[model samples]
Target: MRVRRAAKGVGDFVVESIGEAVAEVVLGVLACALLAGLALIAYLSWSFSPLLTVAGTGLLSLFLAHGAWGTFRDPVEGRRRRGWTAVAAVCFTLVAATAAFLLLYASDCGCL
Candidate 1:
């Protein structure tokens, strides 16, 4: 009886862990999709306006950087998920660089 109970508990734990991992993966994918959609919409709406494009990209970069900072600062999450921290950092960096480039281009082109 004791052996069977232990086996069941272990199985349950494994299932729960897998479920949590799957949920996290799905949520991450959805978040990325949402961000991509927002970028596409911004591009379509602000294509002709350099300042507006810079504003949109800057806002997105700020949002990503904030998220990355939070992830890096969280004690439990920061320790448990180094990969996520790296991913967040990379995303923030890319978005920020894009925003900077857009701003520079706008200024240089006399569009600002």
Candidate 2:
């Protein structure tokens, strides 16, 4: 009975940890997107430098990629099959979507 309780506690901790990680990443991405969008609007209307536009988009893309990698890594980093959380899955999905959008924008291909 003691071993079972210990195992359950560990699993709960892992899941809670995963949730916190996912929430942080989501909040980060949302905040960045909002700020970036505002900056982009300002740049477009205020004749901000072309270099700044490129740099801003590049940085945002890198950030999204890192988030995606981190979220995916969190699931299978240390152990074989300890725990799985819906937050991790949701995080991956969100990151993947943002990454896909970036790919299309970078490629400038409508079909992509």
Candidate 3:
């Protein structure tokens, strides 16, 4: 009886772990799909209107940077602060680069 109970418990644990792994994989796939879709939309918008796309992306980057700054300022137990700081820096760079590109290449597009 003891042997049977132990075997059942082990089996249950293995099944539970498998379920959690599957759930994580599914969620990861969904996230990738969502990101891909967003990238496609951004690309289409950029092709349609470079200025508008750059403006929208710049605004988004600013918001992301602000949020990252706020998170970084708060005390965190782990390495999250470093990650947030990197995000903030990347966002700032993105905004600056986009603006520079717009200014340098503005004459190429007669739409402006």
lDDT of 2: 0.63
Using all chains and alpha carbons, the TM-scores for the candidates as numbered come to: 0.44, 0.41, 0.54
Sorted on TM-score, best first, the list reads 3, 1, 2
Residues 1-112, candidate 2, lDDT per residue (tens digit)? Answer: 9999999999999999999999866655665665567557967945767778778867766665655555556466565422333444455577667666555443442222
> Compared with the true structure, what per-residue lDDT tens digits does model 1 show for residues 1-112?
9999999999999999999999866655555555567568877878788888888778767768765795556577435545656676778777667656444433333212
| Lowest summed lDDT window (length 10), candidate 2 | 103-112
**lDDT of each residue in 52-98, candidate 3, tens digit only:** 99999788767777755655476666645456566776676665665
Q: Evaluated with TM-score, which candidate comes out highest? A: 3
Question: Each model's number of backbone clashes?
Answer: 0, 0, 0
lDDT of each: 0.68, 0.63, 0.68
Show model 2 residue runs off by greater than 4 Å: 48-112
- Better candidate by lDDT, 1 or 3: 3
lDDT order of candidates, best first? 3, 1, 2
* RMSD of model 1 against the true structure: 14.9
> After superposing candidate 3, which stretches have Cα over 4 Å from the reference?
69-112
Q: Look at candidate 1 and give me any clashing residue pairs.
A: none
